[model samples]
Target: MKRIYLSLSLLLLVIIGSRAANFKFAFLTDIHITAGDSIPYNDLARSVNQINDTPGIEFAIVSGDITNIGDRQSMEVVKSLLDRLNVEYHIIPGNHETKWSESGVTDFARVFGSERFKFEHDGILFMGVNSGPIIRMADGHVAPQDIDWIKTELDKAGKEKPVIFITHYPLQPGDVDNWYDVTDAIRPYNIRLVMGGHYHKYMQLEYDGIPGILCRSNLRAKEKTGGYSLCEVTPDSIFIYEHKIGNVPTRKGAYSMTGMNYPKSNAGYPRPDYSVNKEFPQVSEQWLVRSGYEIFSSPAYWDKKVYVGDDSGAISCYSATDGRKQWSFKSDMRIIGTPAADKNVVVFGSADMNIYGLNASDGRLLWKINTEAPVLGAVTIRNGIAYIGGSDHKFRAIDIKSGTVVWSYDGVEGYIETKPLVYDNLVIFGAWDKNLYALDKKTGKEVWKWHEGKPGRFYSAAAVWPVAANGKVFIADPERVLTAIDASTGKTVWRTKESMVRETVGLSEDKRRIYSKTMNDSVVCYSTTTDFPEKIWASNVGFGYEHAPSMPVEKEGVVFGSTKNGLMFGLDAHTGKVLWKHKVGNSLISTLVPLSKNKCLFTATGGEIGLLVIDYKINKHK
Candidate 1:
């Protein structure tokens, strides 16, 4: 009998070993699967396959941004790839998934299979909740059913096992208004781990004793090093490790190389002769030295060389630092727009209501297609076609090489104030008419628009942010309202009224704190999902801020938006209190500029345009 009992005990040990070890699953984020993203879909597929092949990782999860355009086809492509990969996986929708539609709840069911999904593996329960997005994304809430289900799921676990949550947005502790995140719902659960992605960078933290992981985008992973993450979990702890091809991060903008020396300003105003393309300033006298514009779009840089577009409709390649002119393709119209730079092609739009495809190297204009209205936003490139929107009341998909219109949408007309936020082939943006639109990047079909039209959904001045999760888009309108839209169809999910948001700046959210810059000359704080948002404080900002109060810069509860006074105000990213004010004694029409990983509060006012870096002092720890 004793021998029999020993054998039974040995069998029990084997069974426990085979059970879940509380190890981490692989996490991949910001895949950016649009047509011309830095990384391709096939590459990600191979990486996924390889990750599944890795030993000990039982499952995987993607935080969001599975596709760039948020189109049905993009999801189909991604699903097809996932179908072939040998792994059990779950996901959360990011902002890119639904930028145009206000309602993003159905997207998880239609495009990604579901917005909130869960399963039990190895005695641990995993749940996913989407907060949705404010721009081209639909704000997501834990559906009444999902909320009930989470309670049920937790009850099923019964304190015997710790739960894990998967999501696209981050949630940090003691930060700015983070109420829009999963803080409320997840607070009650015995959560051991939480995972999220959306940011291109990698970060980590602990929230209320629960460890959280911020995954990087696959495309961003490739840009930095390799791609993908494999997390190993034990009953006691979770270990997440980054796997990438290269980890070198690409920097934004060109460094100053103009020789006039340290902390220099243009001695005299650059008298720009647009007719002659000449600037009369100190030093270099040549046929217009290479000029860079700080429009809405981020300039792409590769191999120490840089290319950027300006509001004047010029694609200029500069010598990165020296500001030496390499070549420029000057279009016939103003190009105060953004461009998508690939290895060889630069795709963008112009105010002439045209989409232009140019050679990336020499700035050679290869093709241009006119839509006839002011193309206020940047064009999106996927596959071999370029998708663009214009005030001409049209969205066009043009052959990148031929400049021929592949498809076009003429159904809606509004001022396309923001660049098209693409997820898959679905593109989303807001117009001046307070309408958010979603169009086919391939066929230019009107998938949907925000027709719910009410004071609640009216987005007067919302800036479009990339997808937060799979099918979410964030936009703030002039009406001081923030709305989340579904990328596939324009629908209302959740709308926040911030009558103070006259003009919108950037999209910023982390695990604990969330920050947005507006023309209000102030930054507001919503402490948690259940807490009300409060304007932490205000400042004297903006000189030309006829639109709103003053745009502030933000990261980690600190802001540095500009005022019409040509001044940059630094406020606590958390408390919204003034930290420092950099004054060049001139109006800074320029918005906000980031300088480094821990900094970016640097701002340029119009008169001085001098860079001011901010150092924040958050008081929570103190």
Candidate 2:
């Protein structure tokens, strides 16, 4: 009886699949429409007409880069042109939209509904997600929310239904930040095809057991050239056909779906080993505590309580005196940023797209406010309000007392991954859109904005916090230049020599000296008292590929920094001479926390070793 039931279920699936009609759609990408005279309106119009007249074409999917700059006018032009198409369509976001637009992904979303959208046609599941590290602008990263959403949608579709995923960026190991993350999220589901743009040419690839097809752009530089691809989806297999739009319709090529090229046991690629087998250097410390996962966040100290978050989605409080675990709070996802503590309350954001508040002493959950996307930065608390920017492209000020939004500013073109610098009555922060913004703190209105162009772009995605001192705001961008802007007037005061500055800079108490870590594996000191900041001294400190920002912390005329390869350095603050060096263990990415004028704590990540507290007594050195 059981054998008969199983056979019947298989027969029923085959019957349903056989009765399902074959569906076809047009896949267009990289329109790259710009403003004014340089628009691709005619090219897109031709494609629209062709797709409309073509028989059996059910719908269209534009795999990102609809506009060249993601400006409102450009996006509006693309929208109007696409609206002429008789079939329904969907769109995602591309790097061009997130990079060139002043309002980043927000402008694209306003014009096209969202960077992520999904639909069902003829019992087939089709999904589109924006794989944009809009905050960095240099690489691609599918936002955590989008990843989760894809998983949820796949769950709804079940194992037997085929899914087609679309994005603007290629999901290869080096091409995107979290390529394996997306692959891992949907590996359990029956994903049939993955479509991508950004290569500007048609190519088929086998990535992590999925068939990935990249499409060509709709425009050419000097010629009136444009093209679109037709995809035919069946229950068993998929076929792709390319069409070139010219005086007459021309066939480019056709391809049948291919099987996975890599091994199924390893997924995409083998994970890199970040651990070293050597023993760590012994240093005098107070106490140590190890968490179950890696720690990337700097510790927040207040009234003898230390707060920090880890990769395992835990926010734990430790006793500053003896490093005892006092209390802990867990989230559903990783805690990528540090925690902010004040007045018996601790607040932080997580990759789960939720902002959590807890009791500082007891670790009891006070409130949690959910955002539209993942929150990747620490909250900036001022006057009982928590200010944060989320992957949703909105910077919001939430009331700490009630965990409700007070005001939100969604003006920037990129994601907000930085701590808002509250200066005077303004909230100052940077975004992936290469712009620094200042807004009214109370009402969330724009005050002024500054753009980092040409020699340097602020592509660090708000990782570097602005140092507000001496009537100026100083910060280093990922492009290796430091700039000072007048806080009152929002004008450029001066810019330092270009170098590789990918982390937060350190400042002296007198506000005359600035310290920075360079991409060349060197730590340098600069004099801010001069008209243009001048490099005072530099010390060669080797680093590795995993080397984090190593944001140097200062105390009692000494500066301390660490490299990803487990080397730590204590340098003379003024002379830039290395005082001492020590090996902690594995990757040392988190910022050093100063315990006093002399003693401090260094936390290493990537493996088992968690926290180390050292006492560098200044009296002995002086």
Candidate 3:
């Protein structure tokens, strides 16, 4: 009887061990396939063939950056190649897929079926989500909805089953703006490992006791052929091996998958410091609210109400005085552009391929104009006409009252995303085609088109909203140059790389100076009257490596600007003295709307909406 009992116990132990481990899979990331790139396409095809040729590989996990430019054709090409894999594969998008997206970051979802994924295999739950800066150039963010989804999935999986979290970026403060939020959500779960691949190399890291593995990219770089990682799971550990095409797999490292004790609190982790807010006793938040969705545009203020659109295609109205929800209207797709308001009407464009005009008071749709493609451009209202551009390579002037197209220009070679500047009878805007265009506001005729002599669309004057004063149009682009163009003839009056500014510019209310945020740690002002690029003042606000396109707004002697890291600061316009700085959120702050010198309305890409007010009495005493 004793011998029989011992034998049964041994058999049970073997069964448990078999159930806990023994699986193999392929891991690929940062494929970066452009539609016509033969190398990337060939490398991806080889990797697929290799995975198929290898035996005992159950499935695959593609971390992100499946395409180089996030274009629809590139995505479809990637899909066709990936579909050839014999095993199933799960994928997500990286910053590359969202930042320069022509479809407003919607083509990935349309091609891949979802931006996130979740599946269970062999008693272990696997989950993947999108870590994005979205349509703007900022730090990556795990959207609030995605965090909630992770929590729900983990809760359902319970604490007993091991889990693996997959994303594009390594969960760090610099890589992900809200990394702490993600760590906090997964802390209570049985998270075994986190896998990502943005650095294009194999890396072993730890985020508050959670083990992380970053895979090498599939690009060959200087090597003869591209490569990927093969992962094998055992009862006690997971081993990673780098497998290059036409070569043997080299073992990289082994990570323990058992007995991880994640920290309950991020006590010693570095976080965004709000100490600057304490330095300014006068400045305080009046009221703050979270929209629960990503917001890419600034708020539109009209008649004591604030209108803002979000990534979820919901345009919501809030009481401008005290952060109360008034009403909301829903569209079919994401609204990435800011809404423009005039009189009782608010107009905005949606990625659903429609421009909408709504009654400002009740959030009711008054009129909708259909377009051939997504309308990602911000609406500019001037004299009851709405000037906007679309991805269909057309710009239109619409009558806000009657919802009819006053004029349409079909000559733009690329999509438009900036708010058009109506200056001196011309509607001025930039497109991704590497040109700044000036069109007649009434007739939609091209006055003149200006190019920066740069080849790439990234160097185009596309993101900056052209500002004109002193008969010259001032603009900045990704080439890190500030340019002053002849407003009438589109001639380059003066262009300077002296300050290293990129895509953020604004004009002073007095029109004496133009304010631009530098790529590093300063905000430089240029004299609008000078034929040469003359620097008025360069204030080093110490924001550190800043490149957000949040245009500075000057009002009543104060110039207000925000950063990619959610810092809002006020500077003296004439002297460039730092007045007061406040850290608002952990993401990019949009262009601020100054209600007065003491009050301002602001929103952030992290779903933050609030009013900032300065108590003059408190400031006076200090």
lDDT of 2: 0.72
Per-residue lDDT for 1-622 in model 1, tens only? Answer: 9999999999998888777444556777777675544356755876776776666677778777777645455666777776765777887767666343212123345666766678887777778865443222112222233445667777777754667687676654212112222444555546666777766766665443345667767763335344777666664455666666433223211111112111112223222122211111111111122132222233445444455555345666755445465787876554544566664777777655567777877777787666665565655566776666665676677776777887777775454545566676677666656566777666677778774335432344434433323344555555656555555555555557763454454444452333444543445543223223434433443322233223344555555555433344456665555555444422223445443323332212111212233333332232
**With candidate 3 superimposed using the best TM-score fit, by how many Å does residue 263's alpha carbon deviate from the native?**
3.4
The candidate scoring highest on TM-score is 3
Model 3 per-residue lDDT at 29: 97
lDDT of 1: 0.53
Across residues 1-622, which tens digit of lDDT does each residue of candidate 3 receive? 9999999999999888778868999999999999998999999999999999998899999988988878899999999999999999999998889888878988888999899999998788899999997878888998888999999989988988888899999998788888888988998888888999999999998886678989999999999999999999887888899999989999987877788646756677777788888888789999999999989999999899999999899999999999999999999999988899898999999999999999999988899999999889988998899999989999999999889999999999988889999998999999988989999988999999999667978788888888999999999999999999999899999999999999999999999899999999899999999899999899999999887789999989999999888899999899898888889878999999999989999999889999999766676643
Candidate 1 lDDT at 207 equals: 45
> What local distance difference test score does each model get?
0.53, 0.72, 0.91
Please write out the lDDT profile of model 2 over residues 540-580, one tens digit for every residue: 75553322555787888778777654566678888877665
TM-score quality measure for candidate 1: 0.43
lDDT of 2 at 422: 90
The TM-score values for the models, in the order shown, are: 0.43, 0.64, 0.98
